[model samples]
Target: MGQPGDQFADLRTDYERHLRSERRLSDHTVRAYSGDVESLLAHLESSGISDLSEAGLPELRSWLARQQTAGSARASVQRRAAAVRVFWSWAYETGRVPRDVASGLKSPKKQRRLPATVDQGAAAAMLDGALARAEESGGPVGCRDVAILETLYATGIRVSELCGLDLTDLDADRQVLRVFGKGSKERSVPIGGPAYRAVRRWLDEGRGLLAGPRSGTAIFLGERGGRIDPRVVRRIVHRALGLTEGAPDLGPHGLRHAMATHLLEGGADLRSVQEMLGHSSLATTQIYTHVTTDRLKRAFEQAHPRA
Candidate 1:
């Protein structure tokens, strides 16, 4: 058996390679996994775990207990557990370890933190307010901003997917827009009429005015005519949220959550919402149901006569 230090380093290197080459994880994800594994290694070293076989269920549980005592959030604990599990599984599969000690380790029970989604009325008002402000600004950037916001809420697409969109991804007549989401998965989401109109205005007036000699086929263009960056999209959402009362200072995902929550509350089925959001698991989409239920309970308590 390899020494604990060498084994840890080899396991980390292999896991990172797996994430990059086989799992095709993004740089952000790769970095997170690396950091989580490193933290686990540091913990193991501090605990005097000098051999791979020395780690057992008790040790794993103790590590988790320590993390909880240290005030690590449940979500963070769960993620670290996942990282360890992946590492041990890879080690076992590759014969670097006799067996996987982390196989029986359970993650902390995470509380479901439902996203803060705007109500339908607030969402409409926010979109309308953005459009009105764009009109007042009377510039290409303003028009483009309006279109970006409208498209996000209309299609329920993630910001990264939206920014990666090309001109051909839009089908105005059918009101469908193709979005590539996490894991490089693609789905076609329906665009609302208002968003379609905003896009048309931007295409006819805004994009043309902004496009310079270096312009490409990107639907959203910067002032200098290159593809708009995700940071700019975030800034636009932040500024737009400031215009509305009671609106949470959420980024693009907040708009996505708002769209999903509103859809579920408006009678859309969970499976459909799941497909639209491109969530590989239905459990992820179910959070919106909890949001709806909470809202319903609040309405019932406020309006029903039973006390």
Candidate 2:
């Protein structure tokens, strides 16, 4: 091995490559992991420890403690700690470190914040608002907006997955969408008739008007007619939801949460939902259980006479 600093730099590169080529992590995940490792390396440098291999649990705990002292949110600190643990675990397995120094490091259990969701009535009104707006414009963009809102509620796909959709991804005959989710995992999610109608209208009547010379086979397009950006999807959702009186000012993810909660409440099984949402772990899908539980508690309190 060269100097500790050089070893750290070289190992970091290898780790990133491992994340990308071997682990097949998405760009966002890769960046997040790289950022956490960089922060740890910086911390190690400050303590005159150039080699990451020489660092151990005390240093890891100190770094976490410093993050807490600096007022990082518990959620953020937790993720950072997870990132570090994953990194050290990889290092040990690959022989960069003698052992997994971060194996015992534990992040505080994250507070399970219930996702915000509009009740059925509000959701219906929101969809109605989207349809009304579409009729008023009578144009492709309006059709696209209606489709965007409807598909988000109908399928519960991530904004990235929605924006990433191409012409071939929609199966109108079957009323299903081919969704490539995080880590590029693919799943087919069914689309309700209303959403399917809106998408069909957009494809048939609206997309042509917006298509430019640079336009490709993208299902959703920007003003310049290229593939839509996720930020634009967020803005569209916010604007569409804003049109509905008494509705929460939520973006696409809010719609996703609503879809998941509604599905669970309507008797959709956990395993099916896990497949539809493309969740890698059942635990991630279980958050919607809390949403349903809260709803049940409210319903019982409203109707039951035990009080």
Query: What is candidate 2's lDDT per residue for 32-139, written digit by digit as tens?
Result: 988888888888878888777788899999989888898988999999999998999898888877989799998888987888887778789988988888898787
> Over all chains combined, what TM-score does candidate 1 have?
0.88
Clashes per model (N, Cα, C within 3 A) = 0, 0
CA lDDT, candidate 2, residue 74? 90
Stretches of candidate 2 off by over 4 Å are 1-7
Least well predicted 10-residue stretch by lDDT in candidate 2: 1-10
Quote each prediction's TM-score. 0.88, 0.94
lDDT of 1 at 149: 92
Instruction: Report every candidate's CA lDDT.
Output: 0.84, 0.88
| lDDT of residue 59 for candidate 2 | 94
Pairs of residues clashing in candidate 2: none
